[model samples]
Target: MKEVLVGSACAIALALLAGCSAEQPAGPAPATRPLDPTAADLVARAGSYYADEQVLQDAEATLVHRCMTTRGFRRPPPAPAAPVSHDEEWRPDPAHRRTDGYGLARAGRGEPPDPYFVALAPAHQERYQRELVGDMARRATLDLPSGPQLSYPTTGCLAESRAQLYGDVMEATRVTSVTQDLHNTVYLAAQADPEYRRTLARWADCMKRRGHPYGSPQQARNALAAERRSAAPTAAQRHEVAVAVADAECAAEVALPGTFESLLRRHAELLPEAQRAELNRLATSRAAALRHARQVAQR
Candidate 1:
């Protein structure tokens, strides 16, 4: 089983602050231009990469298991979880909205412990780690054209798998970062839009009427997190569920999801030609990688 690295509560709080924002602004015009062919292809390719990587990971796990067994060790192959569908990431589902507050908390839940890892002896565990990550545990830093340097492990099955899928790790990282930045820009734009702000205000008012006064979804999430730290952790669960349901209700009442999606679609059109070309390149690369993955898995 993978060790659940529990950072200090302070660190976790800081991380939550850095990673999530409660408020999402109103979206773009409904008739905004559709995604161009290149962009559409890129999106499809990016989506497919998840499945491709699973294939590669499975193959890599098998290789590792075989290698370990040959050395007189009992190591079971990895069991990858089913792929999650993110089609509704932006879409609001009224039926299940109440089940997970904004769905963010639910999405962030950690994976269950791996049975294979749990069965290993302490010495074998150390040996397995060494073999998977490499004895030297090498690291490398790639200086990106923008942002902070990308530091990555230069050893391990994880590293090897990535290398096999994306030939040049640094280039792949750069491309991924660029795509992410594009999405972030769109999100920021939506947040600043007057229409989005108005809808958010309406949502806030709705929540207030429900006896859960919150300025934004982020505030509610933060409050729930703080409550969990209290002596009665489970006590907050009911409140969390209530708030989440209300959040979704408010979002639906205001047509916030539709607006957000419209804005995202509009912003996607603003992607630069160079970025589109890079996405195309990435798509081609991933296709090849997927083929390679299938062959490796078969062997």
Candidate 2:
């Protein structure tokens, strides 16, 4: 009986050990994979990693920009008019307007500004800067979402987003200014021969008044692109446009700078050798591109 009891206890112990071995024991929980980060985070990461990767990005951007520009990309024109400065009008300084507007224009010392010109005037820019800063302060103070009377934010959102938006708008304004200036200057350049300027301006102004609206070099160009995109022209229109384009190209081909060597020699004093070489290369490349585009357009 003693031997049998001992054997039974041993058997039970072996069974228990076997059960322990076969049964799985729990360990620490598996870690959760992190979630995908937000746009801001991704941008931040890109900025960090590619902070110095300007060469490739810059080169690509430049090429694309040149292509777009040659293809007649244009920003909108200058605001026809900007809002008057109510605050300035209220203060009622008689001389300020004369100085800010007429005086600077005549003196040629600084920019004579309405709302537009003051920003560029080195001398008076500070004054307008102060005014602008004050305006921004008021905007910021009134930036809350609760107002019933407020319109679209001239400066909207908060923090960086607001800053980015404001910057984009401001840049648009500056471009408009410069573009309009370019338009004006091109007119002035034409005015060097007054009879021609008068003739062209009269025709262009008539076109503008009739609501055609493509009044400047870039505008006419962009309009041509837009028109081409919308429809295939009628046979008569195509023939007329083709004839006009061919005439212009014939004139332009004759007007190409005398030669590459002449260009370098003439601009030798003002332009560096590398710059001249690059400019020549660019001009040659651009001419080739223009010829290619013209050929495609004709077909």
Candidate 3:
């Protein structure tokens, strides 16, 4: 079966693990804590902007489908809708937090193949793929401030749609890239903090008492992945649900999520001056993009 374990949240969890170690350090400084209201508001606004961007992307996809139809190619209808909150990265729903342990198992469930595309001739299928994403070799790379390069198609309906929506694809990519990097830095710092490690230990013990002996939520998720490797989709999902519930219960019992959120806030405050400046820029750019997305939606 295809690996479905590792959605956006799981990806973040994996990134966090990079900073974790066997030895715990001193507790976080009281003065450097993450419970600031202003910072929370900023993060909330940033998250809202990301949601707006998704709306714009969905609009662009629709435009691409229309363009493809105009070009005499058969376009499939959009895939069935799933729960939107399920895909959101950072925001954890308290009521459902324990249901998808880090969202890894949930991420692993592959989207069903589109029947329309499947019925198409192989040549048509190839054309559709090419037209949708374009040739990688022909794409342009945008160097991000976060020390990463993003490769995007310079030509194709997808590219055209993006250009129309954002006016400048590179600028859009730069803002989003920097924002992501800033967010990642916080996660890394949180994982490294001694307080976070202590909370994680408590969560681990809670999981252990529940018959899930895992070092961390990420570790538990990995075990689930290996365990479900040969299971049918339904069976795998059942297992994931059970594990996620337990994970959530453990997290709540230990107040890990609240502690983690506070740690992230504290770490975010400790970012280098240059990164903080970039985050401000991202906020400004995102605000502008939100306006543009609204305009696009209206049209």
Candidate 4:
């Protein structure tokens, strides 16, 4: 009896050890952080953009569809219509005098608004009155400095608040492009002449006078260089030419599009193996040099 009882006790002990061997140690859980909308808003604000939720959310679906379908991804459904503020400065010269006012004071000066801006008669106008004023408030919150300078979010006129939760900074982001940025800026400046001439003509027709005004800055720079010598530019002027040329090259490259893979496949196959990138690099440099030379010649 005692031997049988001892054997049974040993069997139970072995079963207990087997169970222990099969057990595993528990690991620590992952750390989590809470959402901070204010901090997020501040970060979004730092991007130097401002717009109502209307604008960003308005483009959500269309943008997603275009972006994704082209890349072969599942696209989301479209968003609702954009929330429009009362003000629209892109309305042209008749309504708001002095175009975007360079974020200047709100005096409603020299303004003859479009005849079409009617808001369902009287009562709605008072409600939407805040709409335009609200836009002003949002822009004021942005604290834009007054000067004959570029507007905030430089590309478009502000339609609403300046802060975007998810802003479109293609213009801002393009500044970082490796081979494209510098050349593009120069390209824009180079082509700015006709614009300058046109603006000058318009301002002149308005009985205003400012040489090299209302057009491309090169008009101004060229005018400045005219004082020294038209044939030979100074070293400083040569440097300006270099910058303008580089910027122009970047712009031309930008206007010419197609992904590197697709574009290269079409043309690169025609080139010798060793000449692909080297050819590009040399051409880019030569173009920049020629622009600098032209500026010097103009000087």
**Candidate 1 local lDDT, 160-219, one digit each (tens):** 655665676554454455545555666677677787788888888998999999988778
lDDT tens digits, residues 1-299, model 2? Answer: 55554556547768776532345789988653221222111112222222222222333233333433343433232232222232111022233332232111223346344554333557555543433333354442222111222222233222222223223433322222322332333333433444443433544555455444433333444455455446564533453244233322322333312222122222232333333343344333323333433343343
Indicate the worst ten consecutive residues by lDDT in candidate 2: 35-44
Instruction: Go through the candidates in order and give each one's C-alpha lDDT.
Output: 0.63, 0.33, 0.65, 0.32
RMSD of each: 19.0, 28.5, 17.6, 23.2
lDDT for predicted candidate 2 compared with the true structure: 0.33
Error of 3 at 34 (Å): 14
- Scored by lDDT, the top model is 3
Separately for all candidates shown, the number of backbone clashes (residues 3 or more apart, or on different chains) is 6, 0, 6, 21
Error at 222, model 2, angstroms? 16
At residue 195, what lDDT does model 2 achieve?
A: 47
Global lDDT for candidate 4?
Answer: 0.32
Residue 193 in candidate 2, Cα distance off native in Å: 4.1
Model 3 quality (TM-score):
0.69
Better of 1 and 2 by lDDT: 1
Off by over 4 Å in 1: 1-74, 82-127, 135-138, 143-146, 168-178, 271-273, 290-299
Higher-lDDT candidate of 1 and 3 = 3
Choose 1 or 3, whichever is better by TM-score. Answer: 3
Candidate 2 wrongly placed segments (more than 4 Å): 1-153, 156-172, 191-233, 256-299
lDDT of 3 by residue, 142-259 (tens): 7665577878786777776666656776666666565665667677787889998898889888878888788886776777787777888667777776767777777778887668
Off by over 4 Å in 4: 1-119, 132-138, 141-147, 150-185, 190-299
Cα distance off (Å), candidate 3, residue 4: 80
